[model samples]
Target: MAKRISQDQIAKELGVSQSLVSLVLNGRREGVAEESYKMIWAAALKQGYVPRGGMHPMHAPDVQHSYVGVVMRAGLALAAQSNTFSHVSHGLFTALQHLNISLAFLGGEGDLDETKLFEVVSRRDPLLGIVILGEVKEPFMQALGELELKLVSVYASSPGLCHSIVPNDKQSVEQLVDHLVALGHTRFAWLGGNAKLGRNRLRLAALKERLAARDLLLDDRYVVNAEGAERQDGFDCAAELMRRAEGQNMPTAWVCHNGLIARGGLQFAYLRGIKVPGEISIAAVDRTRACTEIHPYLTSAASDPELIGAEAAKLLRSQPEEIGQWNKMFIDLVAPSLFEAGETSATRPE
Candidate 1:
């Protein structure tokens, strides 16, 4: 009988680790760099090394890889915050239970380096799909795209790269504007986050469009963007806005990027002896209990994170078995509903 062709032989021949050869042979290529992946596979083919189970799915008949992996783009600290991603995860967990599909959390960005990501993927059965909880950079996304696995992103979109489920910013902003206008408040200020992010940009733009339609101008001085995404950034930006609007027309209503920043704004109000909804009304685009941690709960126009997660789960589960069978990229947009307007948002101050 001919000697068995083991992973060790292929690894030694290609000047790579036996573990790496094993990972590639097991069909976990999501974290492997494209060039390295091709080289390892080409080497395996040249050496006529076949996996103990069978050939690669791309080369052999399709196998049912039922497992799905979830990767959080944010590090552990940021992900821990009760934000959209966390709620989406709750929905994903609940929906996946009925789908009868197993779920695996690969790790957050900080937890999984290249080798660790590959190791995690290898340890599991071949994954059918991956659910990305937040926005990822181009290079990171490119590596995932190279994998033959399907991808679904929650609260973000990668355009033609993968399917996405996101909140409808335009509709949500419209609802918020309608409410503020009904309160007889025309002037508005945006306490926002980094503009480089598409989500932030979309929210800001939607606010501008809605305000313009209502014949209200969002003056440049009133739009203060936080230097960072933390609570302190919100406080600093709010102070800056107050200074800039000093002796000038100030916006009566304020809209924040998310509950975290919104909470920060409320703190600034307390420190400055400014009463929320009494002196200036505050609202958020995303909801979190932290917004309510203060006296008045935050009013928000936001989608249900659980619903978004559930929708993402369905989308991932509906993916075709064969990677080649995927259709044009799918995008599902869920609209936001107003919550607790009476608590934080009030009639415009005279």
Candidate 2:
């Protein structure tokens, strides 16, 4: 067999410093010129060299030639089928397609079980990485850390496990506050179940902080953080808010936690003969497209799900090169595209 080319040989041949060659080979050319990056890419492809492990057992198939992998998740990537599902998973899938990574679904045992989920990716070697799309628990995430499998998380984030792709709730929440406030709506009701879930709690806290900054309070009576964001939670929460008329006996607005909750809030308002935006304007954090299906579409400060999928996928793909490197590239904020004019805005109700 012919002698293999070393990094030194490639550096010498390219007439560039080793660091520059390394950066180009590893696809980190932030400051470097595009031409040099392309030159290294072309040479590396031609030489059949992958900056990622080339001969290690953990090494995946040549992404340059052919790479195959599966998209394992605790639940089906239903966002692909219907916008009714979480848009987050769809974001991860979209990213995979762009990366040219073959994506497949291997649904787990349904409880966010780690072993079953990992098994889905355990097979099909030469897989670039596995994108576990949603509802995975921390234990399972920890296990993935041990597998040396390149991984990306869409709905959740963990430091020791893998790369993550999440939406920017801060901006989304703050923008929502601004939008609602602009409509001349001051008295607000937040209807959603409360839980110990980290992300959900973050949303609630963010809402409180955002509102407080404007001298607004969530008014505990209007906010039902007792139940989770389940459909029943939404319905009950809405029902409770109306029953008590907590803030002003006749509140001017309602802001829900999500589309599902909005559905419940809408239903509660309609059956009770309250006209949306007429008697009580409503808005919430809705990313899924289901909001439009409702007669009076919900106004949501929603994040883009497709972008979330792609960013997560991109991060997962980077895990291999970044294995020995301690630094992590966290992508928790997929810029959201909030829509205010979508069928659910009007001057604060009389």
Candidate 3:
């Protein structure tokens, strides 16, 4: 058998640091220049380096054959068609691909059967870890705890259960409220999702706290529950507000639950010949691509689903080697969202 070429040999041939060679071999090229990456691959090929795990020779031997399992809760899978969850999945997949790690998607639409999940994960032979997306029920979580596998949670968290990655919804709402208040808009109307949902409840509570600091309050009369965070729900709520404005004063600004609601509200306002920011300015608590792609770009506090996904991947990849330590490890990671002042928001009109 031919002598195996080591990473050190490749590094020497390319005249780059061994660390850089290791990163390239490990398929982590986030900060690596394209030119350098190409040279490294070329050098590895010429040196006849055999990567472990039966993957391409350029991949590191340790990870080439490893796999990670992504378990999406039934509820989240049902809503996976939506852009938000899809973006998160996309980011996760992208990172795994770059790492040259195979992925096994086990649960979706089945409520995550514990026995089946265990079987699927164990079948991987060389499974590196598992990532759970969305709210996983307690029973399922308990089942997972018995697995002795590295676990990472995304979009939901259970204290001392596993590492969690989620968006900073509270801060996002705070920033949006501050922007609206600075615009001299005192009277406010909230168009939000079902109040029972934890995320929506957090945003609502943050809004109230920020308003209270300014000696203002969110009028119950103006508050509308969308029930579902859909465009139609937003349109209906806006129509109701318009009707109420006929008999009483209207809020100077409308803070929507998300971009979809803002779009729906803007559509209704346009059809009614109500000028946006002229009659009523509009903003949203959650931002997505829809905000920027639509006309009159929505001013919104946007959370990057991709960033959340990437963070989850990072946490999983950097797990301690000892699976036992994961059970004792408690990680609460929050990725902050940014506010974009698009064309829709403006100073209060005189």
Candidate 4:
């Protein structure tokens, strides 16, 4: 094994005190000047000073050394199973590879709390930037903003904090509404509008606006706010609405928040002996691999996870000064497409 590098050596190289170098390497940033913190990390990385028993951040075993950190909402096992997360990862990795910057995966929700996460990024490695995969708590996000690293978020945004890349909800809502309206459907209902996520809230608001533009109204009784954005949440919402609509007129068409929720709507249909597209039509706002996992493929609007990921990576690759200019946030929007040929939706019943 090659000989280890020391804080003494790094401090000497940078003309800084060994004590200051030690403090910065240990992730301390309270009183130390920002310039000194940056310098200490730069010198440590340049001199190949890996912490004892810790893998070198730039020269870890089996993979190229990394300078970019990827923080996800869930662990890799769960994320890999999600089409949206997987596609986003694929796009991010591809772009990072092209830029010749290796990626360091920070622990997910189960592995670390916000405090631990903050410590790791500030101390563990000389990471110059970070790529957040999905929504995070505002306090945690604000904490991250205080770090001296470039930050980019995929699927979410925080003004004055970091650049964000997200799908075009307005265009997506238009496609879904237009397709269903063209099919002769008049009465409509919304399913699985989880209010916790900003994107979900945005979609719901856009749906109402789109319906209003066409001189249609989404009945307050038919709009179900999901408890969570899971398939089971979709099923529960559908069941409640179905029960309430007994001996009453049910909406001829339903718009779901996501493919999983749409699948749950289908499940409720299966359980209740309802004929899809013949008795009622079901569609979703976002497309995913889940759309085709069941008997009849779900028709939905498609967001480009890959494009969002790539754009976020591109933002992080640019200089911090270039990204953080004029107090203007970068809200990059990628337009969505429609999967209108699926069997879930059809012309309104006579």
Candidate 5:
């Protein structure tokens, strides 16, 4: 068999002392500079240095003693099963795997039963941390707080409840508006869903703010509210907008809530014989695979669910002391969104 990689070799590669490498590998990160700690870990992973216990140094040296728990709120599970959320879960899973951490899906049922959650976690024996994938009611949050585990929440934010990682929806809306404005489209319509959903509200507010910054106004006549963010919502909303525009001048472009809505709107526009980007431009806020599945790739602001998931996992593994400092502090950890230009958006028609 090939020779196994050693901490000494890892230290040499990272230009740090062997003892420093040992400290990091052993999870004794006290007093180690963050940069050096990361460098040592990276080198160890790159060199394939398996510690004496058959675990990578990044893994808490006690191999079988600790496990991370993922708690999915029933409402969140529906979204989690979506293509975007699948990517997010994949990122979280991959990150934990690299750390040699096993994950337990504590609650099989989507409902957030405090008793069941408590029972599931209580049986996990020395649970390292918990990652909540969606919003939980106050009672549920209180139940989680009682557990006193290092907790990281994804896609949902509750003050003083847990560390949160969410997509920058406001920033995404701003980028989408900027893109459409630059393409010379002045009149715009927002195709969105329930205002009760925090993300939908944030996106709408951001869209108005961006439009106002450019001296453009979102007239009440141009806004269409659907039941939800599903594809059918998009289709219905698009049809409603078409009816509303029957006699009045049609908006030059439409900004959809997500790829599903975008697809539905695109389908409606095609069936109505409206030339995409020829007669009207279309854009959206998400970059899921559905964006490309449509006829003309959608012009959208994309949020990387995988990146957010990985970051959430990283927060879960952080020192308890660090997380303690964040408790009661309403911190918004927002990830940036990327804008991808596609055929659906173009200069305003003359």
Candidate 6:
């Protein structure tokens, strides 16, 4: 039970105004350095301090507890079944406890009814609003409206309904490509492209634009569209692509859509006895369950699943008036944090 640190401490430490500290702390700070805001976020996450709903931005309070409802997208549950899920959930729950908020997980196939979900959330003692952890279905959004919950969208936003916290898509992809390009990788292959949902599509599109700017465009032969939601499909897609790669010629590197596909690609390459990087460098855009818990941890875009949870919490507490002010609130987390080059990447063979 750590004593709650005030926003004033953050403001003083950063030599910024209390207002700005509150803004950045509450996930609303714009026009500030990304690294600087992360410094504040690190402190809050460390201290486990979630600001209470309807609390004045600058005032510190002494109430010991509160609660928020969280509606996670369906895919996260399946992914969470991974070994990394426990680690990520622990991080998020630890932060929530420090803030005195007990999370009530709602909105999955088990109990996805917006109407029923809201009924349960409303029954929670001292409930404020709900946090939509991933994609929001009409039912979930409708349920929030039924409860009159101050809804928060964790990743994507619905303009006037809630605030959002997502990775900087174009910027993150551009930075990743820039890093790989700097490594002398010109020819590239991708595992998951052509999805119109969520951020991967945005990342993939930006990857295209950025690479083309460098006079490096992926030929039709270098792309793989994995259209299903299973690891086997990922493996099959990567295997199929490798077959294609053999037919066309030598590509310098392969950047999968996310780490799952990256894992699949790695396995596919390993099975084929194609020494990664020694043969084809492997990388991915998103960082979850991709590079960890395996030999030669993946090289990928850094992602904090807990951040997704945390952002959802923030959006839940924000008021409608505040929501209108939110035009794509995002947390830019891309510093090219490469973990364990892992023999997956190396210099191009002459």
TM-score of each: 0.77, 0.70, 0.76, 0.76, 0.77, 0.70
What is the descending lDDT order?
5, 3, 4, 1, 2, 6
Cα lDDT tens digits, model 5, 1-350, are 87899888887776778999888878887899888887887677656566676533334545544578777755544443245666677788888887667777776225657767656554424677887776556677778877767778887887777888888888888888998888898889999864456778778888898999999999888788886677778899999998888888799889998888888898898899999989998898886787787469999896788898889888877775765564554355888999888889988988
* lDDT tens per residue, model 6, 1-350: 66667787767876777787777776875787888788877665555455657354234467646676666665567345443333334545666777777766655534577547645653425676666655666655655556655665655665555555555556656666776788888888767732545655666678799899999988777677766434555687688786787766667777776667777777777788878778777776655655565767766664465565554555555555764433334232222233334446677655
**Candidate 4 structure quality by residue, lDDT tens digits, 56-102:** 65666555544687777543444454457767777888888865676
Candidate 1 shows a clash count of: 0
**Candidate 4 deviant stretches above 4 angstroms:** 1-64, 73-83, 99-102, 108-115, 122-128, 320-340
Question: In candidate 3, what are the lDDT values of residues 87-174, reduced to their tens digit?
Answer: 7777887887888776777766355677676566544256778888777677788788778777888878877888888888877887
Candidate lDDT scores, in order, read 0.76, 0.65, 0.78, 0.76, 0.78, 0.63
| Candidate 1 Cα misplacement greater than 4 A, ranges | 1-66, 74-79, 100-102, 109-120, 291-295, 319-324, 332-342
Q: Write the per-residue lDDT of candidate 2 for residues 113-172, one digit (tens) a residue.
A: 565654544443456666665556666666666666666666556665566666677677
lDDT of 5: 0.78
Model 4 Cα shift for residue 130 (angstroms): 1.5
Q: Which candidate ranks first by lDDT, i.e. highest? A: 5
Ten residues in sequence with the least summed lDDT for candidate 3: 74-83
